[model samples]
Target: MKTLPILLSCWLLLSSCGNNSQPAADTAATTTPDKPAPAKAASKPTILFFGNSITAGLGVDPEQAFPALVGQKIDSAGLGYMVVNAGLSGETTAGGRSRVGWVLRKPVAVFVLELGGNDGLRGLPLTDTRRNLQAIIDTVRQLSPQAKIVLAGMQIPPNLGADYAAQFKQLYGELAQKNKLTLIPFLLEGVGGVAKFNQRDGIHPTPEGHRLVARTVWAVLQPLLRQPMAQAQ
Candidate 1:
């Protein structure tokens, strides 16, 4: 213990001679911590177009699609918002249900629901179709409680049987009324039977057809837009 203390004293003496003292931090300074991600810009209110090929504007200029048209109108009106096209070609109501969450991550203020056309084309059962669509609406309302819903209806060709078509079209009305939402009676209003209005595939709409669909959808949309965000029921 005596030898250890002598060695420590010699080490201290050598250290002092070598001037190895620790430096003091400057106290007259301010520390600026990193800024928090700039708040992600608080994002402009978003419009989510969650539909299938029709909404995706397949086989047409992407910028000229109906959703794009709606966005253009909203922009021109200075709504201070952005639109998200979540449309996937060949999507069904069930598919919409499956991906609803991923789309909702955006700051969506309004939702344009246009699915089930493929389901109608594929001649899916009405019960299954209705269930899927209902699930999607329920999921979306849960995500954005105050978000407005504009459900677009699709019609099946007569060859598919009137019974099936009746059930299919009826589903939209029932769901819309039940959910307290606005309904665009038929998405393919003027384009369903007109070859000039649809593409060669006779499924997706032509550019002009899309414009018509936008006009039809907009009729329901116009009144909704008049409702202030705070007063929207």
Candidate 2:
């Protein structure tokens, strides 16, 4: 009951936020004819984080976003990967499907799929969400065959109905299994539903919450980065 109101309020806030602000630019790399070859060679492979407000670091400085924090971790570990945060506040799986092509203009080594939360919060049709997500995944495979996909699982509060909540939570695992993607059991794990971890929004995480999110992601991502391609798959 209370959780439903919280999710509803979050959806409304995110919708308003989306209208007021533009989503962050897709930080994918581009090359020009005049670009120096050595500079190109020095460039690191990209790890693209594609998702919604949570990934966009809404209500916080861009640097405090989990993707950026992950970039910091990568640097500290001396991993040769660049993070491109392609998070769009209020984005749904359908929106992600529509825009993912532009985001994939540049090649990426890893693609972290983080959409669908907004879909669940809005009580949209689960079938549509699943279809759109599968489409996005198919597009990624078509365009970036070598990229490792990391699916970020999400859960909706039971206010929508226990069955809907159960299905929503189960969708991520289903998608991951169907596509053989590396999965993050629940992106918000320790932060979700925790009053201290969320901002006034009671939706988006605080800076400290992002740190916890970054850690959760890193636990799965770190090993992938360290493993050989054949083994990682």
Candidate 3:
């Protein structure tokens, strides 16, 4: 994730796109001026994509975000699952930790945790980041014991210093191993630092970049999708 100002500016740019696809229902917070209505229970299982602006589709139409693209892939493949993009712009691990419980208010078949980029960007302490992430994981497990989780690993520029960068990169692998979770080693595998794949800001992905990201996420997500629901627990 980029700085707040950069993300806000990018959001403004993307939000101006007249044809932006509607965000997934689960992520949209709506209210009626009259008496509040009760939420209807979901008819289908949900694959919750939890993350920051990247997952929020910062510089592109909402439909172009990888999570929404993955949703399209699911529909094309005839998978009867709903995709919930719970991405909030400029979110850090601590922020995610605090909000995950509310986000998990419904049953989730799969939880895709894509966070920590902002923490890394802000040069937050590694220990605090790990702790907050672990707390989020623990909350998910506690709230939805049977839900399968996929962790999206992120990286920051080496300008932070090699040791710090290397440790940050390794942290995901260790967490995935310890938690026995499916891990996407690098969320930006083929697109990071690639001029053509990113927006002019060089942090967020472009429409094409989101497609590549969808493929990366799909590689791991597809298997989990194919697994029998009862067997995944």
Error of 1 at 70 (Å): 1.0
Give the per-residue lDDT digits (tens) of candidate 2, residues 131-212. 9999999999998888999999998799989999999999899999999999999999999999999999789999999999
Candidate 3: the clashing residue pairs are: none
Q: What digit string (tens of lDDT, one per residue) describes model 3 on residues 126-222?
A: 9999999899999999998899999999998988899889999999999999999999999999998899999999999999999999999999999
Worst 10 residues of 2 by lDDT: 1-10
Report RMSD (Å) for each prediction in the order shown. 20.1, 10.4, 8.7
lDDT of 1 by residue, 66-137 (tens): 887776666566665455667888898888899887667533567889998889878888889889988888
Off by over 4 Å in 3: 1-41
TM-score pick, better of 1 and 2: 2
- Compute the lDDT of residue 65 as modeled in candidate 3: 87
Spell out the clash pairs found in candidate 1. Answer: none
